[model samples]
Target: MVERSHKPGPISATTASSLPQAQVNVSDDNSKVTATIPSGDTVEVLLYGATIISWKSNGTENFWVSDAAKLDGSKPVRGGVPVVFPVFGPPPKNHATSSLPQHGFARNSRWEYLGKSTSESASDDSVKMDFGLYSAGLSEEAKKAWPYDFGLVYSVTLTKGELSTILTVRNEGKEGFDFNVLLHTYLRIKDISTTTISGLLGTSYVDKVLDARESTESNSDLRITGETDRVYKSLAQDTTTVVENGSPRFDVVRKNFRDTVIWNPWTEKAKGMGDFEPKTGWREMLCVEVGSVAEWVRVEEGESWEAGQTIKSLV
Candidate 1:
């Protein structure tokens, strides 16, 4: 296991022409930026969908990407934290619903690399990077479906024992538009059945497994028995904890995101998925996503909306 250093200091940046140049690597279709803090916690980001594919600290992998996931850009990679924008799940009930694809085009579309920098906060020595996507650069098919002009800037930060992803969306069009977004985070664990999620007590959720029925969570720590798909709407707090066996695992915190989604496909659904390998991959992963789902958020013309989530390891 990699050990995390609690010492305070910033990592030296490589310089070019008296300016600090961020460490980045590009190969073929994907570009990766690695951020290493002074304490040795490291994060690796793939430019494809601004996805965070790897985060290692204290010698353990904190996130999961499917072994059978396609990296050739043919479809959204089945793991990691996929950026779901403009829509979530299936198309909404509307006249123009047929135009938008599942989870919109943010995941499959290529984003422009905006480079990296150090954090401005006095208490932070983390490294941060930015990526952008503009509707003007989208394909004609995507343009025809959602014609509103927009800009999305995704910022990722790697700090000691933590990783943060922030998304900012600007409506450049003349009229206001409404949309939903999510960070579809797939977290790795030793055993899915032994995991318990806390901090959702008294919150009402829509159980997708129960035909989208509304229900309230009464348990302080939720355990998964079978196939589970739930969306906790209008969250009262911004943090949730995932505990494996009797030990704390990860603490997920979010801002400007009103909903939390917990999902585990279990046996039947896992066997039905071609991208999830080994046929028993469901036992090792869980999806604890934080985002603004359940309702559409409206951004006025020339205005922007910001939301973010941070994952901190407890082990």
Candidate 2:
């Protein structure tokens, strides 16, 4: 059985020497970093994909990871927030990203932790950490697949009340590169049947599961009952909320992210995937991804682009 945990706080504690002042800890194996605040909230990120494996707030885990997720750097981490870059899904023939694999190489490539910036005060207790991935650091195999010198700086900030993820892409070579980025975030909830999405009324979307056709939404709040794979484009607003029962549980606030993807594998699709353990796990997790996926963002030589989203746990 694939069991899920609604565990409170982090299972791993921060290192002893770094706690009193910064409340941040790096794993002994140098594989992951965990940051905690005095309020007992914590977040853990693996350097493998710079994937956020766990994030806890309001004394509950806000992100979901599969019970059988691979953590040995074998493949892309099964859940949490996985960074999709250069390509979103399959690559089109003859396109710049055609030479790359699905979802590009960012999630599978190793990243470097560039350290954290201090910002603790009597009124504010937000911690920010940055990770970097550059063309020069990629493996030769990855370089041969899609050769373009670029730099990616990903920042994760844990505020007293919410969590924010920001990304910056810089062209480091004389040649330009076209890319797409998506923060594939999986949110944990009590029940999919009772959960509803708000703030996407009248927005047009492409139904990936339904012949990839376009249609407009008519509801201000929508519920998911079965398999759903939709790419909501040109969102009417920047904020999307997950409502459970009659109360709001989480608010997804985005910045410069032109698209929102609401997806759930549901029953049948969930069982077909090798990584989605505890097949029934789909009942408790929903993917609300944000990115610039409707069209590719072309970075000119010596130029850069930026975008991000902030998820607030209202519960």
State which candidate has the highest TM-score: 2
Candidate 1 residue 293 C-alpha distance from true site, Å? 1.0
Q: What lDDT score belongs to each candidate, Candidate 1 first?
A: 0.85, 0.90
lDDT of 2 by residue, 66-140 (tens): 998999899998889999998999988999788888999999989999999756555666678899999998889
What clash pairs does model 1 have? 1-59, 2-58, 2-59
> Candidate 1 on 240-266: residue-level lDDT in tens?
999999788999998889999999899
At residue 93, candidate 1 shows an lDDT of 71
lDDT of 2: 0.90
